[model samples]
Target: MRSHEHAAIGALCGALAVTLLARGRSFLEKLALWTYGLLLSVFIDLDHFVIARAKTGSWSYLTRAVRHPVWAFTEQESVFPDVEMKLDRLASHVLIGGGLVLALRPLSRLLAVFSAVVVYAHVLADLLREIEVA
Candidate 1:
């Protein structure tokens, strides 16, 4: 996708986050949710970078750190650490997603009461695939 599209999507995400925070949730809850998203985004980006670098023969800083002798040696034992980590990641995502949805539920209901059509439009737009033309 183009940078502009990414920016627009990011803006929409930020607005949705802000709206949820402002309307039905406490500032701390909003902050925590936002932080969760921030961390999730970082992880997603890290994974993306890793995959991209693997494809193109480049390295991200974090990947490089993992390649360093100390870190690589430390991580060598973990081929697969059971299902606990996977379950934990799944639980965290579900909790964050559900929390955000619940926080916005009141606002969404109120919007529906007022007949607003744009309530979940951002989310729909976000889910739509971006087809980039070469």
Candidate 2:
């Protein structure tokens, strides 16, 4: 899926998160949680750069994407083609989400759960997109 699609999904998840988990939070607090969730959901894909480094021994794709943020994000399929399914590894999404949730747990249960759910939602959506594309 495109980054924008992930973002739209993130936006929806953020709204749902605020509705479901932030009951009793002040408006500003709820807004903060929603924003955090959305940002987390969208940025979790940054792990792909680490994965690329491990597999390809360089950050060519990451740097290219960074250099052309708008085109890289909007034209992701063209910018980051996976003709051979080279980007199919699962560790990036799963491990990063797990690690983040573990790290955030001590700070606040709400933050931990919210991060886990948002990451899970992002991964699930990506997996579903993979399935559809395959």
Candidate 3:
């Protein structure tokens, strides 16, 4: 799936979560949660550069992204047509997300649970994308 697709799914899932779990929250709070979820889902793909570098032992992909920040940021799927998709990095993404939830747990249990829910939504979107790609 493309970046836009990920953003779409993330937005949908985030909104659903806010509606269900944040039923009594203010509109602004719900919006903030939705935004947080959307950002996590979309920006999670930024780790592809590290994965690509590790696998190919080259920085060409990173360089391309750096040189074409706008294209890389907006049309990421098309920006690296020569490079292989980094779908294999899902485990690391999930692991990092779990750590985030654990780290946030001490600060606020509600926030930690909310973060977990959003990350799960992100994982679900990625899983569906992987299945579709396969």
Cα distance off (Å), candidate 3, residue 62: 2.2
- Highest TM-score against the true fold, candidate: 2
**Considering lDDT, where higher is better, how would the candidates rank from best to worst?**
2, 3, 1
Each candidate structure's count of clashing pairs: 0, 0, 0
Number of the candidate with higher TM-score, 1 or 2: 2
**Index of the highest-lDDT prediction:** 2
Residue 8 error, candidate 3, Å? 1.0
Model 2, span 1-134: residue lDDT tens = 66778788988998897899889999999999999988888887777677667767878888888898888777866754642333454557788889998999999999899888898889889888878977
Q: How big is the positional error of residue 119 in model 1, measured in Å on the Cα after superposition?
A: 18
Provide the TM-score for each candidate, comma-separated.
0.32, 0.89, 0.81
Residue pairs with colliding backbones in model 1 are: none
Model 2 stretches with alpha carbons more than 4 Å out: 82-89
- Between candidates 2 and 3, the lDDT winner: 2
| Residue-level lDDT tens digits of model 1 in 39-64 | 43333222333443544566644465
Q: Which stretches of candidate 3 lie over 4 Å from their true place?
A: 73-75, 78-87
Worst 10 residues of 3 by lDDT: 79-88
